[model samples]
Target: MIIGAQSALAQIIDIPNPLGPEGLTIPGLVAKIATWLLEIGSVIAVIVILWAALVFMTSGGNKERVTQARQTLWYAIIGLIVLLLASGVAELIKNFLTGNYN
Candidate 1:
């Protein structure tokens, strides 16, 4: 009885697909890649901002360190803006191709 129960419990079960049925298509793959890039870019932006803030806080009135931190912060901000714009452009292209835009 124990062996039989163990065999029954060990039976393979199919798990439902997480990305739904459309995940296998080209558009779905492109969207997934774009989403991942955006997420990673946002994370990098946050890290850069935090590092700049830390540098600014610990500069102790040093002009060079303060200048470096300012530059870093500005660059990170610009990168974040560009990332946002890219994401918007991708969305627009996808909409246009799908004929979903009004």
Candidate 2:
């Protein structure tokens, strides 16, 4: 009967699953996703910076416009810093999992 076969299968020991190519693991998966996010963020940052540069160039010495442009640039710089920190943390996690310190 099916129940008998199920019981027999349950008696067998559990075997670990094999990892496919590219060394898939929890940390590896996290690092891969983080890298992807970093790439996307970098692209967005570039776009924002370029937009800010264009704004500044078009401000034509107007104080208010220049202030807005500078603010945009400042925000972009903060975003870049946060993204860099996140990337560093991802790298740290990857290294820790790989047993590579310093």
Worst-scoring 10-residue span by lDDT in model 1: 1-10
lDDT of 2 by residue, 15-83 (tens): 665544555988667666778899999889889999999999999999998999999999998999999
lDDT of 2 at 69: 92
At residue 67, give the lDDT of candidate 1: 100
If scored against the real structure, what TM-score would every candidate get? Answer: 0.84, 0.69
Among residues 3 or more apart in sequence or in different chains, the pairs in candidate 1 whose N, CA or C atoms overlap within 3 Å are none
Best by the TM-score measure: 1
lDDT of 1 by residue, 1-102 (tens): 354455756878898887775456878878888999999999999999999999999999999999999999999999999999999999999899899987
* Candidate of highest lDDT: 1
Compared with the true structure, all predictions reach lDDT values of 0.93, 0.84
lDDT of residue 90 for candidate 1:
90
